[model samples]
Target: MAETHFGEWIAAHYATLWPELFDPALIGATVGFLAGLAPGGGSALEFGVGTGRIAIPLQDQGLEVYGMELSPAMAAHLDGTGVEVLVGDYATAHMTRTFDIVYLLRNTITNLVTQDEQVRAFENAAAHLRPGGCFVVENYIPRLRDRVFAETPEHLGVEEYDLATQIAVSRHRWIIDGEQREFSSPHRYVWPAELDLMARIAGLRLRERWSDWHRAPFTAASTDHVSVWAKPFSHSRAVPNS
Candidate 1:
């Protein structure tokens, strides 16, 4: 089984821990981009929809939004938000119905921590997408050249990567009220080409890839990416060109 990094403590202080993600401008931009794809009464499914941060606003934009979450504590934040919540692992969960779009945001894909699980996540997303539908993902580019470090008066964070295993361990320690608190999570960092292969294996084709939500060009210097893959209209085996 995969480990769930987000739990009661993380849920309770989610906003506090990641305040930058709550910015209205960023949220608006993200919703605008997604809403553009699902025009004309289309429906959306958010994988790892934590705290209804984007789902709520997207729903308010007249889109039918559903969520698949692994943590009940995090899903609890969506109470009465009108966004249907399915408490289960997004990588392995099965839904009876399909949607116009399925998305994973904020580098949440890395949480799977294993290549097989990540591939399964893509397959599951494809399974939930309607014909010609899209599976979108927003994730950070792996920065193996330089290590990650976060330092503050109240907190310290360090991320170490193992090239052989492609495992990145994020370790953190926080001092709140003069008491010590610590947490760590493991992630399997994947390259863009690898993700593309996974999408192909899932019977989806790459539609677009950008450096950010603004549709900026993806270049070698880019540190993050938002990629979209579309399911073909028919699942029948493709015939070779004559």
Candidate 2:
């Protein structure tokens, strides 16, 4: 797989192309609210924290949140929010602190071109988690076929419109590996099962899976998004010889 052609250009135009890009904070708040329901009520680490879309709000919700992002431009956007934003690639970056919950949301995992890199990302997350901590991930399940030419048209409201920008955002499906698939925006796709396998290989166990932030049941009709929660290795201390 080739590297994405537009990195710097995308970083520059991210805010303009996706006017609702900042809306992930709402999604993050929802996540924090749900995670708070769990025992221990832990802190969070957001991988690929673009422009504090999620991290800032998660922090505002009173969860101790830190961010690891690759783009300096995105990190700079989080300035003065008091959230710790580290500029580095999530695949290779290391953090001294571990969190009760680590998350990689917004279909950011697809940014990795190959399965190997994606698995490595899981390992990194596991390493950053304390024993019994959870790793939460939200991603779209790739369609088995491409529907890019299916011609199902949809429109956005005027608030989402940018006339001077000349940027028309539309949903389309494309065929990959003989599967009919839909991409809401331009992005690489991966199978949810494949992600689960990657998590297993990284010594993490899947505790729960959902179709959406609302915890909808996953089914065939669901192709939009999936949220997975994985736990680190169990911490059963060995007793010293009496």
**Number of the predicted model whose TM-score against the real structure is largest:** 1
User: Candidate 1's residue-wise lDDT over 101-211, tens digit each?
Assistant: 999999899999889999999999999999999999999889887665568887787789999999999888887668888889898988888998888888888899999
| Candidate 1 deviant stretches above 4 angstroms | 149-155, 175-180, 237-242
Which candidate number has the best lDDT?
1
Scored by lDDT, model 2 comes in at 0.64
Estimated TM-score for each candidate: 0.93, 0.72
TM-score, cand. 1: 0.93
| Candidate 2, 188-242: lDDT as tens digits | 4566777777777777777777777676788887765545545545643321212
Q: How many backbone clashes does candidate 1 have?
A: 0
Which pairs of residues have clashing backbones in candidate 1? none
Per the 3 Å backbone cut-off, how many clashing residue pairs does candidate 2 have?
11
The list of candidate 2 runs beyond 4 A from truth reads: 1-16, 20-29, 32-34, 37-41, 144-188, 233-242
For each candidate, the alpha-carbon lDDT, in order, equals 0.89, 0.64
